[model samples]
Target: MARIKPQALLLQSKKKKAPSGVSVPTIIVYILIVAVMVFSLFSTYKYWSRRSILQTQDGISNRKFIERKKSDIPNYALISTSKGQITVELYKDGSPDIVNEFIDFSQKGHFKGMQFTRVVKNFVIQGSKIENSEATEDWTSRGKHYSQLNTSLKHEAFMLGTSKATHEGGGFDLFITTAPIPDLNDKINIFGRVIKGEDVVQEIEEVDTDDHYRPKTPVQINEVTLKHKT
Candidate 1:
């Protein structure tokens, strides 16, 4: 030891020293913490998503709902199509503007002869644009402009609504959703919900669509007939 060089002594000391390491329990605790944090974040995200939808619904509650006799609590619309028919119950009790606009349009035959312009499986099947009703086998002939309808309704599956008609547009065009679309609730002017012919809506959504969302085989909205319940 007395003859050993300073560098050699230092090396020997280092060699004898054990490497530091975390205990097994400490590692397990860290893993549990990470897992809990991940779960907490996921739970929080889910909670907020649900809360947002509810908030939009609450907003809908504040709007004007149509007053009707007890027997006529639910209004109805018959959407006749090539594949089949879909019957929707207008949310007239809680959405008057939306229900009124739809009734007016249907009585005027504005929804007839419109094709299923865009169809996305499990999401939405957009109806032919109003301008396209006059077209021959084409929807792009008229400029893409959706007329805005005056309403405070929000979009939801089966419910009817309107907005400007651009990619950022709403109102003039129509669509039927096959599933719940929380994102659309706040942006769309919803007024109706499918009651009898939901299967028909599902059938249309099952149609084959092109890359551009156009159905390979056309599904026409043969006509939209409205009726009041007795």
Candidate 2:
């Protein structure tokens, strides 16, 4: 046999060499690609999650408001006003917190000497503000407000609503509607209806108001007495 050249043998050896596993640089590139993909997915998930939570908050808060059953105490609200007395039969089923708190405060004389602060002709006449009973200017439905509840009762003709002057919430101000205000239904709290003196509510509404709907003359709430049936 002829002697093989060392160069030829070396070439043959090089050609027969097997490939090792993936190179360090290639493995590093793969790891980097996987990390980037994970980061992108995580960022997308975070963005959508935060958006969903904020949207649900508003709906949840309104739905979470408490509703109470009518009490056995024969609850009634006797609003003695300058125009006349309006007797409201309190409801226990629609909104309990509003009814109970209002009666509780009325019994405590918290609403003593309060007055009607706002009036909308053919719509509503709101009062129950203890402050600014004398001053027409700088007084709103929020005057002396102490309670809050999500709207429960509807605004029908001769119906009563208690709300803020701006209708924002938590003024504990009284609003009595002489006409059906479908827009205000489920948007404000109504704890009672005028079982007596609906005409009195109309009389209060007929009182003159300024351009801002503030009564030109003060309509006083002499007292709010909570009475229970014997």
Candidate 3:
């Protein structure tokens, strides 16, 4: 204690300066840990913010997708006949009411298996009406005459025309005008027209018929199919 050696003095001084709990290296490690925790919090906040933004963008995208899908529906029809087939382009733009009614009748298969019963030379071959006169008579006996509510649409050649009803009831009847009769245009409702299959119409018109104007062999309508164009 009175006179210590240099090496011993150095060791004693080191011992005396030793920390009670933590060392310098431990303090540096604690500072590094705090920095890492702060950085982790900042990264988590940024990630959350980005995720929220993405979610909002996805919602907007989904809304637009649904709106576009709703507006994409088309209106048209495909009528299949035994005499080849007829592609009818509906005139909803000019005749919405008649077109709607025609679509309804077509979809219900009301026009299926009907004959081209009334074929006038150089004129329309009428269909979509009951071929059995007995059935029509029965309907008449019941005080019902099939009549369609009149629409503002006019008759045009190759266009669909409905029959006027004189009695209480009206059934589905359609005719295609053979030639452009401008005088007859305003008298009837023309809902659709033949885009193809005019040859079929010509074939039907050429068939032989009896005095009652009935074809010797009926030209049957196999089916009427409705379709929307893309």
Candidate 4:
């Protein structure tokens, strides 16, 4: 082999130093790949941050939703009479104040052993504040005061009715109508209606009654059991 001149060697070295077409394209691809990777990382971080914020908001909303659901349900009153057990479905939608009061009284067992002293034949059977006028120490000793009566609840057939005498003396008495009495729907607090065992009401109404419309033979409410629907 012949030795190359210095000038020729320098020229060959310069040609080699210049990037090839393939090399230039490969560099461009690498830069694009690096940019995509960086963009992907930024997008992932932003998505996670937004998801965390949404989770926090959902937590608070979930708690409020549960509380509202709890407040919406109205407790049922299952009154066992001498004829048969009558189940009444109370309405808490129209009268929250009355419903709460009734539930509180029921929970305290204020209705146990209360007689159905007033049974209007073919109309309604009323009871609740028997002790209020019975003069029994046990009856008088019980709490008689309830919150101010809202005169909005009315007496309808099968609908529950609260006595409308005066404040602090009306929470204990209640009545159930046997027919559709819409006129009384808004005038009194009709909490609920008999969902079952209304036949027992007809039997009680047929019983012998005194001039005051009270059943000659005492018909007592054996127990009033409050329950919820399954």
Clashing pairs in 3: 145-169, 146-169, 146-170, 147-169, 147-170
Give the per-residue lDDT digits (tens) of candidate 3, residues 1-230.
58878999999899899567878898999999999999999999999999999999999999999776533423666666777887788877787667777777777887888888766554456785654343434433322211221333343457667765421345777777665544455445777788888877777777887655567987878887877871
Over 4 Å off in model 4, which ranges?
1-74, 131-156, 167-170
What overall lDDT goes with each candidate model? Answer: 0.67, 0.69, 0.68, 0.69
RMSD values for the candidates in order, in angstroms, are 21.7, 12.7, 11.3, 10.9
- TM, every model: 0.53, 0.54, 0.55, 0.57
Model 1 scores worst on lDDT over the 10 consecutive residues at 141-150
Each candidate structure's count of clashing pairs: 13, 4, 5, 11
Clashing residue pairs in candidate 2 are: 68-96, 69-92, 70-92, 116-127
Residue 136 lDDT in candidate 1: 35
TM-score of 1: 0.53
How far off is residue 9 in model 4, in Å?
71
User: Best by TM-score, which number?
Assistant: 4
Q: Between the candidate structures 1 and 3, which one is better when assessed by lDDT?
A: 3
- Stretches off by above 4 angstroms in model 1 are 1-74, 130-157, 164-171
Error of 3 at 136 (Å): 15
Kindly list the per-residue Cα lDDT of model 1 for residues 39-154, writing each as its tens digit: 99999999999999998987776543322232344378888899888887787767776676667767778778888887766456778554333233332321121112222334
